[model samples]
Target: MGRDAPAAPRMAAPAAAHAAPAVGDADRRRARDIHVAIVGGGGTGAAILHDLTQRGLRCTLFERGELTSGTTGRHHGQLHSGARYAVGDTDIARECMEEVTILRRIAAESIEMNYGLFIALDDDDVDYTAAFERACSESGIPNRRLSTTDALRHEPGMNPNARHAVMVPDGTIDAYRLPLQFLATARAGGATIRTFCEVTGIDSSDGRVSGLTVRDYRSGRDERIAADVVINAAGPWAGSVAALAGVGLPITPAPGTMVAVKGRLCNMVVSHLHPPGDGDIIVPQRNLSIVGSTQWKVDDPDAIRTPPDDILRLLDRARELVPAFAGAEFHAAWTAVRPLSGRTDAGGRELSRNFQVIAHASDGAAGLFSVTGGKATVLRAMGEAVADDVCRFTSLAIAGRTADTPLLAHREFFRRQERVHEPV
Candidate 1:
């Protein structure tokens, strides 16, 4: 039931090939082959920078705070195998399934292939198991069912009341480390990663984006950065960024709250076999077993609070899968805003998690684009899709190598430039 674009104020049309933005001598920017300005330094932005830089495109990425300060900083960190959404959304399910293997290959060091267990706690869950399995099979998400006893043996903390269980390829991830890897690789490949930089204004001329005005949060100094193309990968704040160019991005900030508890409640990720619901999934990360998430619509991504009721509900639901969670003791909690691709009055859960890359030329603004929606699991794919738009706009023939190449270690991001690439 997740919504796509065309929800409010009308969505932009798909761009026609060869309609790249117009660049002129008046545009003030660094003298480079082709410069792409990336606004936002989260997973999506970092991925875009990685893809473009690997293809020999120069890129400058700006983040208002630290790299993972936005929605990227706070997440459930589930490396989705696409099993959860297979029953409802085939496309997203397939995307997750395909990306899982790719990420395992490219970012192996940051992903935990610990696998996952879906427990059906009641007779209703048992009856729904067949449908779930069918959907996973149909969506190409490999899975195997397990007996209640066998399942408990694997996860000693699993609820004994569980009637059925299914094993999925789901796992945990280092959300921050993964993106930092992307950013680091991009930097090693000659892209600039700027932290504590806020985009203050987007400058446009004759319906074409010329550049953006950025302010250093530390220095309180403004600088103008021009580029052949400007990318809006601002996540939940994408709409506001587009507004600076007098464009309507049709993005709704859907915020979800996740709570982490002390102690690892299980050895693997856990979830309910039923439809997507609040607090239905449990992910064991390191020494902490994190339970998430409750979705709600919010206007401002920055002005959100984790509701006490949400924390209680999450604890109650998580305990159903693992009784140990009932008294695990609270560790940490936070809210993350998802930049869902459409503006709708629909409930947050009803909105789709699919991503959309919009070319502003279709909306009468050239040289600008925005990418929103999807989760951490599909970040590279999201970047590839958007990088295609950027490439087409720049009239470059470079193909994406993000899927094959391992990133430069995050610690080496600022070291002497080195290219991270794999053989074609």
Candidate 2:
């Protein structure tokens, strides 16, 4: 996690002549008129909205709060290359690899291309390390073994007990910049985004979704927006969103707590090549060191706070990797809920990381869909999958061109505009 800078300048509202067209399929001669409502403005939802708008679909994004005010904004910014799950979760590893490469290419402005290291602190785990390296190699991820001396030289703050390290292509990402950049590009491509709008109800007749009722939190005004389709990409709140439509979705909310320190303890991402455990990874961001995390199932995503005991446990484990991190000033802490789907009795950690696209048409309801599960690094891939489903149901012939298109081009126009209005 990084320190929160002053909020970016707000863009001017669309002109009256540029308002979204009225709701009518025939009147929607241009893609800007075929309205699609997306609930939740987190990374997954934002990525989906970007992809949809880029493919010429009119999109409106609704968030109950600011963009990325959910799990997408509350995470250790390490961009995994799928190596972390190679030991037991090969499926997640594969997905991570594909999306990691794609995001590095498309969203260059939001990524830091630093490599990651997984260190083994004891000789007893050398065999496990070797097996893990082999698994990564077989899974198409490149892993190189680093000697203890070499590892210590690279990261002087590393624990002297660290005996071996494996280097992989992992990097840190700006979670804040990632979604904001997506929103900027989506809006540029003609998407309408309304923050602080909370979706209250789903209006359906004849078993088909017709529109959505939303309340502007700031003005306390209620309004309804007609839409051809309603997508639930509310991260941990997906279940609640479905309930508004009288549908049941089995989404389990799992919360993880992370701590941010005042400075970088290591120049690259460092992790323990072991099962899910507390403080197994340390990620370096702009001016802070992010050490996390502890996973526990929760009932509400909004109730996120870091427990003191968990914070102590994290510091203890982190010191084993970097001894200099022992007394680093605690800057801040936060929690994010991971949306898991499966039988509640099956356990949240056991649930697959792969995402699922649910269409209500098969269950007697039409024009509604729900996307759940998966990590932030793989959001673009998930967006592609959901967009394909939406196009099939809408009878739209738009092709999925987002995979090859760069999301946003660096332009001098925004820089010049910012300079003109910058506060002294």
Question: Candidate 2: which stretches are off by over 4 Å?
Answer: 1-33, 409-424
Best by lDDT: 1
In model 1, which runs have C-alpha deviations exceeding 4 angstroms? Answer: 1-32, 414-424
Please count the clashing residue pairs in each candidate, in the order shown.
4, 0
TM-score of 1: 0.90
Model 2 Cα lDDT, one tens digit per residue, 1-424: 1222232223323232123333455434555456789999988898888778776687888999988998898868878888888777787788887777777766776777677889897665676887898888877787888887887777776776777888888888888777766666676666777778899998888888888999988788898889888999999999899889888888888888788888788887888866657799998898788888887887777867678888888878888887778879988888788887654664466777668889987554588899988888888887888888887887766666555555553342243232221111
Residue range 256-282, candidate 1, lDDT tens digits = 889999999898899988889899999
Candidate 1 lDDT score relative to the true structure: 0.81
